[model samples]
Structures are given as C-alpha cells and as structure tokens.
Target: MQATLMIYNGTAAPDADVLRTGGVPLAPARTTWPMCGNTCGGPMQFFAHLPVDYGVLSVFVCQNDPGACDTHDPVSGANRVLLFPSAELVPVAVPEEGVTLLPAVSAITTAVVTLEPEEADEDGLPPDAYDLARGGWKWEPGELFGKQREVLGSLGGSPSCLGDDRLPECPSCSGVMEFAAHLEEGIDRRSAMNLGGDLGYVFVCRPCSQGAFLRD
Candidate 1:
C-alpha cells in the first residue's frame, strides 16, 4: 500500500461489519500472510476497517510487546495502515500464530443521523482539515428517543484528540514524526478497544515505511 497521511470522517466509533481488532475479517483475504508486524515479527492485529471515498482502509497494530517495540517511532513496526480499492480488496483469516484476539462486542446501530457540513468563510473557503476534524465531535449527537447518539455515515473529521501537539518523535532519526490517523473506542461501550479510555494516535515516516502507535 502506498503510504499517505489521511484522516477519515466517520462515526466517532467504527461501524458494523467493519473489521476491528480481534474481529474476524469480512471475506476471504487476498493472501495468507496478511500482515506481518515489522517490529513484533509476527502477524499484526486488525484494529479497524474503514470505507473511504476511494475504497477500504485497514489498520493494524502489534501490541505483542508494546514497550519493547518502541511504538513512538513511526517505523518501529508496531503498526500499519493500508488502503485498497474496493474491487481489489481481499479479506484474511486471523493468523494462528499465538496472537491474541482481544475481546470486542457486537457493533451498535446508533440510528438515522445527518451531519452538518463544516462551515465555510464569507469567501466560501472550505474549513481546514484539522479544524473540521476537531470541531466535528461536538455535532455528532442528537436526541433519538431520549439518548444522545450519532447517526450513521461519514461525519467529517471526527478526530479523537487533537491540538495537544503530542506528536511522537522518530526513534531512529530523532526527527518529528507526522500525524497519520486517530483511533477511537468502538462506536459504543460494547465494542470499545482496550485503549484504557485513551485515543490511539498513529504516526509514520513514509520514507522508511515504518509506523508507530501511541495512546493519549
């Protein structure tokens, strides 16, 4: 997969039938050796399955030995993000190499919802990507029957945490790594990943094909 920095606009949590950490893949994967962790030296655990404007995006992470992997380094081999054209997509079975599949619950159906587009300026200039993702969080919920929840569909830039300038540094070069994506707890209480109430931050050093995962 060509490495690119991307931010997808979706529900704060992942959606149904979407691949997630410890969840079985949707269809036959393209290959047997789906993803091998660069640092962990084994198959990486699936973390998310996202459908974007182009196609599907799959995210994986290696928590085999978190601290030992130096997850703060983008090329530490602890994490990976892949994008694929829907037509060419193939699903993979979970590797039976002693990898633990963390517990996840059934996906929640939040209900019908509509998202308000990010506001434009008097000149009709589109809002900045960072600003849109940061602000989109507040507009996600509404009173359904009585509970406040998000409607299904892309909400545009629902970044879990931003503006803290907590970007990680590359362990190899000591250079500042680039922010890549934000991972949240699953759509609700049932399917939430074991992030300990922290959002997962992904970073990458494209030239090195190395990635890192962090939580804050």
Candidate 2:
C-alpha cells in the first residue's frame, strides 16, 4: 500500500482555541505567570497545546538561561507541562500589564499521512504508539481508539518513541533529563524543524530551564 499526504493550514485567531496539535499553548485560569524555575523570573515560552482524552496539555520552556538550564530534566525547572482536566477546563486568563504570558501565536500547517498496516510494520518494527495509531485509523475502532490525528498530545501520558530509548543527561546538574515532548513534522515536510522526516524528541531539565532537541 502507498501512503497519502494530507495537509491542513492552521489559522491564527486571537482568543480562539487551536484545534490542531501545533500552536500556542493556552493556560488555565488561576495560574500565575508561568515562571521559569531558573533565575529568569519571567514567563516561559509557550510550546504546544495538545488536546488529549483526559484534558489539554500545555507545554512551556524557558528561553532565559538557554545555555545553562538543562532543558532535559523534568525537574529542571526550565520547562513545564500542565494537564488540565477536561471537565474542569477553564478559559485562559490574560496577563497583567507589563507581564507577558506568551509570545505571539502562529498559524500551524498540519501535515498528515496515512500509513497502511503493511507499510507501517515493515522491517519488523515493534508495535508502538505510531503503529497503534495507524491500526486504529485503518481498522475503524470506535472509542477504543477514536479518530486518530496527525499530531497527538502524548502517548500513554509519555513521550512518543523516537527510535531510541536512551534519555540524555542534564548538562548542568548531570542528572538524567526527562522526555518532554514529541514533535513531528507538521508543515512542509522538508522544513519541519530540520527533523528530516523523523520524530523529534524534546528533553527538558525543568529546574535548569534548559532543553535539548533530538531527531530520530
């Protein structure tokens, strides 16, 4: 079976929820300015806002000490991921004067491709989330899998596989960093964050406000 490519151009609408996988992350109410755990004392940069079955997952990374904070450690304080329950979801609040909550939002260009089962299992690749997603889409499993989207929130509350299981160590604290996000090419296939048509892994050291990007 051959693969087919489908594209969706995401539009930027102020004060609107981005239904796609890639877009500015919106925060829940009552949360303070997403402060960097480092010395930045400023709001972290908004990454992606993914809608999952349980709720919306908002991701943010610190841009202040980009060189120091180990962006790979979950407890590094350089990045933050917040999961808001769907039932208790609230409107995103605006930041006070002079306090910036996030950078400018950008339109997303979603790139999706259908992976036939025959093509997905090539080379005896182990059954993983990607395989499950493709299977769910082709087999028409209702509720058990639901409609599979190109950009997924997170797989089983964990980062999707990127060909390897090795987690990098923090550059600053020397601790093993945590898998933060899995970024796939969404726009122009050739121009997606230089991922080279492979999955991108985002590792973070939360306390360090540092991050590392790797492609597999």
Candidate 3:
C-alpha cells in the first residue's frame, strides 16, 4: 500500500498555505469559534489544518478537561471536524479562556511511502500499512528506530488501527463518512495536540458538508 507521509518542516506562519498542526484556525466569514459541548463548555483546541482535494479539513478537540470530555467519541461533542470551502477563509478570533490553540505552529511536508505486506497477513490479520511505513522511516539509513518525532501522520489513506464498526456516519445524511486523514500528537511534545497516546481519525461526508473526528 502507498501513503502520503507528513514530515515536519519546522515552525510556520500560522496561516501559511501548508498542512500544519497548531496556530489559529481559518474559517469562512461569520463562522463562530466552536466551543466544547461537554461539561467543560470551553472553546475547543485547534488541532490541524489539512488541505484535501475536496476542501480543507479543520479539526478541533476539547482540551479544557481532556479525558473528562470524551474526546475519543465521534458524537460525544468533544471533538469536531469541519470541511470548509477552499476560498475566502479568514483566521478565527482567539478566545480569552481555556486551551484554544497549540503552543507552536509546525509546518508540514509530504513524501509518498510504499510498503510491502508482511508474511503475517496470510493469517487474515494484516498490520497497518501506515504504521509499518512510519515505523521504518529513517532520517538516514544508518539510524535505528527512525525519526518518528518528525512524522506528523498521513494524508489520504484508510484510518490506521481502526475498525469498520467504529466508522462514523454523517449526521446530516446518515451515510458512512469517508476516511480523510490520520493525525499524530505532533513533532514537538510541548505543542502537540494531546490524543491520550492514541491515533486520531478524521472522516468527512463531502456532499453533506459535514465531518467527524475521534481517536483510537
């Protein structure tokens, strides 16, 4: 399988036209900043700004209270995924309270990674292609364990280590959402979006202009 691996390219201008984690989010005019719907009831933390073929996928998760808000549940009102039009987006106004943005704006670059299946697949249980490719990504051939911190996750692939039964449905149309991207914590722990040591999944229903986010 082939996947587009995201590489960290150092700090970036908040609104730069690149894949990135952290910084202020860009949204259409009159779009209000999304607030967490759980007991915390504070502004959700901005996670990533992913530009895809269809549109830009903006992600947010509740960080005001972390696990207490159930950020891992798609419909728990803890995490949100927004698919916005490619044009006329403006940076959203920052809120004065709570954890609303990441501490650093990390830019991203991409590389196409190809992986060959392992022999274990013969038993009908195949390892995640994205995980395999990422785990083997080395800054230099001589390096052991690879530079995993530089990896920001993947674009345009099926969710890693996720099950079909957990795939979320679009709230508007009641249709299964398409897998959009996979997100890691970040290259820098100080500014990373907390995922409770799990991978984040993004799903979208382009026709309905809606999306869902969860972690596993």
> Candidate 3: misplaced stretches above 4 Å?
117-123, 139-143
The Cα error of candidate 3 at residue 49, in Å, is: 0.6
Worst 10 residues of 2 by lDDT: 1-10
lDDT of 2 by residue, 32-100 (tens): 546777666667655555454445556665655454554445456766666555454454553443223
Clashing pairs in 1: 28-91, 29-91, 29-92, 74-210, 74-211, 75-210, 133-157
Which one is best on lDDT? 3
Rank candidates, TM-score, best first: 3, 1, 2
Superposition error at 117 for model 1 (Å): 12
- Tell me the deviation in Å of residue 138 in model 3: 1.3
List TM-scores for all candidates, in order. 0.52, 0.50, 0.94
Candidate number with greatest TM-score: 3
State each model's C-alpha RMSD to the native: 8.4, 9.3, 1.6
- Candidate 1 residues lying further than 4 Å off, grouped into runs, are 1-22, 26-29, 32-39, 105-181, 187-190, 202-214
Model 3: lDDT equals 0.88
The number of residue pairs in model 1 that clash at the backbone is 7
